[model samples]
Target: MEEFNWLQLLNPEFYILLELGGVKIGLFVVLFIVFAETGLLAGFFLPGDSLLFLAGIYSEGLMNQFSTHNDFLNVTIFALLVSLMGILGNMTSYWFGAKSGGYLYSRQDSFFYKKKYLYQSKEFFEKYGSKAIVFARFLPVVRTFAPVIAGIVEMDKKKFMLYNILGSLLWSFSMIFSGHYLHAFFLNEFGVDLKHYIEYIVIIIVLFTTVPVLWKILKKQAHIEE
Candidate 1:
């Protein structure tokens, strides 16, 4: 057996190929991955933005597996389904937080858990109130834990649902459409296949979403040392 190359984490296309292998699972894997990342703590490490972007790029083909539709319509449908999963995922995390949030805070950190993330999410929730749900959707690790904090705090169910839907829809649609349109724009306008450049795009996205949290953590650690 070969040692796993951690570099593959940068490319979400790998999972779509490695796990589903283009098996016509269509939206199944996309929805599942979205749900897992937002809904399940273990899914924090799984690809999120990139997967949605890749889905956008390949939205037509992915959707064709189930039902045929116009290109834009196909991407729209894909985005909607992805949004649904994201919403559900957030709800799951919220429920877990409501049920076991106290336990989570006291639980020791391990390979699968990080209390700092939970705390950071708590900060965001405190600062932004309910809006953190929408704002955190754009952040990587924070997105996973924000709703959990909300649950732990016992935010109103109706309020959580409202922001969850709005956030999920905005996040999924923006990412997917950006990929879809950009992929098409490059190909149709410049004879470029955007998939060839997806790795770099994913890198940009990771940095874009991950930087602030990293900065905050580093800054907080520095403050503690001082």
Candidate 2:
């Protein structure tokens, strides 16, 4: 049997094609991926922002496969569902942290578990408080661990929920809808089909979001050495 290439699953292009092909299973796959990325510690490596954006771009294709009419309403509904999935994923993460965070924190780092990630997440949560949940949504690794940190810190549930909902809505709507509309604008204005540029676009988006986090880490390390 051939080994399953988990790396291929991380590529947004894989999900983009599935979504564009109107594979009904694509919807569930996308939702499951979003949920696991935010909710599971093992999911830190999964693509989040890029997948959302690509889903937006190919949303019309997915809709057209199901509905006879192409309209903005379908896109809006799809974005809403995606946003809700993100929120639920964070909520699940929060619950897991609330349940087992202390036990995990007490253990030594192992091959599969790194205590440093939790420490970094703890510092981020302490520095930003409830706002970290919102800001982390735009960040890559931080977003995956922020909810767990919040739970570990025993942040108020009601407050966490408020920020979680706000962050998920903003992150999901902005990425997905922007991709959907931007694809339309580029095609209509410059007669350029954005699909051909999806790989480049995804790279740019990943770098745009990731560079700030790297810079902050570097600056903090430098300050520590000083």
Candidate 3:
């Protein structure tokens, strides 16, 4: 894993091979990744926002990689498709929680599994409601766990999906097209090019998202000791 770009694992070439290997893998990787991020307990570290943003940016370079159409229209279509994939993934995760999270919360469960990660998310949902879905979509770690927690805590499915779709659309497309278009706009504006700006943009997004999480963590710790 250290030797791999890991990030490139999400590239179109990788997806083509996933298809060739008989996975019927039409955006399923993106689907699963988003689902795991939203629903699975330990998936918060996965790069949901950055990945979508970068996927949009890389689609132009990957036209030949997947032997697909090279135009922005095709790229936009693909990005939107995957954005829907991500939303559906979260819905599946919600379904998973609705189906099984109850059992995990019942008397048969052990303390570690019952008292740890799952309950934290449950508390977050209990405290926030539908607003949690929107706010959590922007937060990295909590975003991954929020929707599933929403399901486990018995959030209204219709309302959850509504918020999930809205947030996913904005989060996925805004970052993706903004990076793609803005990078192009800036490069074309300068005499030559400023391609390295993409890396800066990603850093800014990550730091911008992560700071609040860090703040919340520190705030909670301080309250605990007081």
Candidate 4:
């Protein structure tokens, strides 16, 4: 028997999400994370972007999640369900923002919620116009609050839903499919298993998703100082 390393405990796919939840319920964990990341203000900490990617590797195209045996069928069903969660999550966030926009603006920051993120996402939405809805889906913190900003502004429902659906599908499908096919390519062609380097993969994904946001903040501060 191989000894389990505690460090791998930090890797959700390697230990927590998949092992704890197993195939039967792991899919729900994935869906909930996706929903929360976009829908809840405090859900900004959720590793939604990376989870989608990792799901492809561990979920095996979510075959069991949707009760499908065919390869294409499984992928389609899994992607759609994931997208639905994202869409619904955005709608929930938007609704919350619409109802409590003033209170949110006055609320104090805490461990889970930050007003800066809201302001930053507002700037992003203002700068990008309606397209921010799509761009935010890939960016971590921005995605959490972009819909909120949209809602606060009272964006047209039809327009918001249009971009929301497009953004959710593109983000979910791209991440999952890339993870699925890319993992297979590496394993089959080069014989490298991503699971072996889960920690490094997590670090890389985190950096890829977050560094840009930090950099932009730093650059804006520099401009202010100038």
Query: In model 4, where do residues sit more than 4 Å from their true spots?
Result: 1-10, 14-24
Best-fitting candidate, scored by TM-score: 1
Instruction: List model 1 lDDT by residue over 139-221, tens digit each.
Output: 88889899999999999999999999999999999999999999889999999998888778888888887888799889989
Residue clash pairs of candidate 3:
none
List runs of model 2 lying over 4 Å from the truth: 1-7, 19-24, 64-70, 106-113
Candidate 4 lDDT, 21-87, residue by residue in tens: 2345677777887888877764566777777788877766345645667765676678888999999
lDDT of each: 0.85, 0.82, 0.64, 0.82
lDDT of 2 by residue, 108-218 (tens): 976546777777777888899899999988888788889998887788999999999999899988988998999999999999999999879889989998898789889
What TM value does model 3 have? 0.73
Candidate 1, residue 83: the lDDT equals 90
Q: Show where candidate 1 strays beyond 4 Å.
A: 1-10, 18-22
Strongest candidate by lDDT: 1
